[model samples]
Target: MNMLHTQLLQLKPDDIIVEPSVTPLLAGRYRTKRRRQTLHTHKQFDDWVTVSGVQKRRQRSCKVCALLRGDRNKSYHTTFFCEDCSHGEAKCFLYPKARREYNGKRVVLQRPGKVGRRKKTRRELLQDGGAADDEEDD
Candidate 1:
């Protein structure tokens, strides 16, 4: 409780706090036991309302959920992406099985080389118009 107060105060002016009211829209799977859950129950702490409001910033948009669900029908600006994603490469989100599509995409430059999607062969190992091992056998 006390730590939350300090964290909220330290937030950037542009940052938004994802409370219970806003968490559903941000990430529906967030655990209810999280500290932000306490913010939803405000009647008991009437005095702290003003203090909390000043410190906590509301989320302007749910970047995490948007990237995971990819429900944006209209053209929307992207803000987040997996570090290993590339412009033309296909990839699933960190929890691909849980979602139908990736929440976001990224250029290869932004991603780490080691985190790329599984590949059958390295680009350097590929031979152009040459006899491969299987071809020689045939």
Candidate 2:
């Protein structure tokens, strides 16, 4: 009874375990057992409300020509041009002519001057009685 108990204690569960065969046939069988997609041969209809709603949103029209700016026929190759106004040529009446400054030999483009209140000098301020206003607190 002591010898049988010692032998049972020494025996492992892994020693009696049955492992499956690692052959290609058994491996291929498991690999091919995936679920297939179901086929539906009926035609699906699109929601017309959503489609027309997207189409109903108006696109930006040209200010000069008053036509759709996104039109493919009205587009130019190098620059944008209004078809109805300047006969599809690049011309804008609203655009102001750029002022050119001549400095000796070089001619440079001058930006428009800002229209604001000009700063007066100390002499000019004193002449205008502005110095009395500052001296009043002192």
Candidate 3:
């Protein structure tokens, strides 16, 4: 737990990327454990909610969910915000058996977040003085 905290604190905001999930609305903002079932929990101590997936899953800062909340009309075990994902255990149950839909829509390891989420580099941070230290705390 301490090491996770240290690593978490060492992370920079630019290290994380925010994106919309294809299955944008599946579960709620928070999840709990019961009967040995897997569920999403608040991973970040600050709980910024970069991303989250259902049990037998996966996340980004959560503009995807934020964007979909008002539009969804139905949901399933992994429905687009179905909100009754009790059928989930360890295996995936994204509705209609479209397993491929559960995958992340985009990933760019060379960069963080969106294509241009961060325009500054470590050298640039250093140029900004204490700003770099503050960034490390995110």
Candidate 4:
């Protein structure tokens, strides 16, 4: 068995390690596993949203369930249902499918180009500091 596994087996059920020394190794393993699961779930959800049918349907229907059922009594045509299975619009905001649709139309807003100040050229860098012989050769 690995050192960590052996050490873990040696500990009692109720035993707690007070020292920070050993906790980090165990914590690192836990964090790695947690991160892997999180990435897996993210990729799974992304793939589901990007599917051909899902993408087309999401443009017109509610992204939570893709259902068209509406309540006429409340006169809420576009009111979302926030149930246990699907947390309605709140949860939908986390997925891109829900954000792209608008009243049976796909809202296509042009994304602005890359932002932020431009990188300084070698000449500009030399001006900021004393020009070095090595920099001039480059």
TM-score of each: 0.17, 0.20, 0.17, 0.18
Regarding lDDT, does 2 or 3 come out ahead?
Answer: 3
- Tell me the TM-score of model 1: 0.17
Worst 10 residues of 2 by lDDT: 94-103
Model 3 per-residue lDDT tens digits across residues 1-138: 999999999999999999986765546545544575554332222112234443333222242333222233223323322223424442222333222211244433322233225578988878887877779999
Q: Which RMSD values do the candidates have, in order?
A: 25.1, 23.8, 27.6, 18.0
* Tens digits of lDDT, candidate 2, 12-120: 9877878797855666656667665533222222213345446432222233322212233342212232333443334432112222322122335443344346798
Candidate 2 clash pair list: none
Local distance difference test scores for all models: 0.38, 0.41, 0.42, 0.42
Q: Write the per-residue lDDT of candidate 1 for residues 7-119, one digit (tens) a residue.
A: 98999967976566642344656645554222111111112223544853222222333443434542222222233432344321222222222325443324223433565
lDDT of 4 at 125: 93
Candidate 4: worst 10 consecutive residues by lDDT?
39-48
Stretch of 10 with least lDDT, candidate 1 = 39-48
TM-score, prediction 3: 0.17
* Model 3 CA deviation exceeding 4 Å by range: 24-138
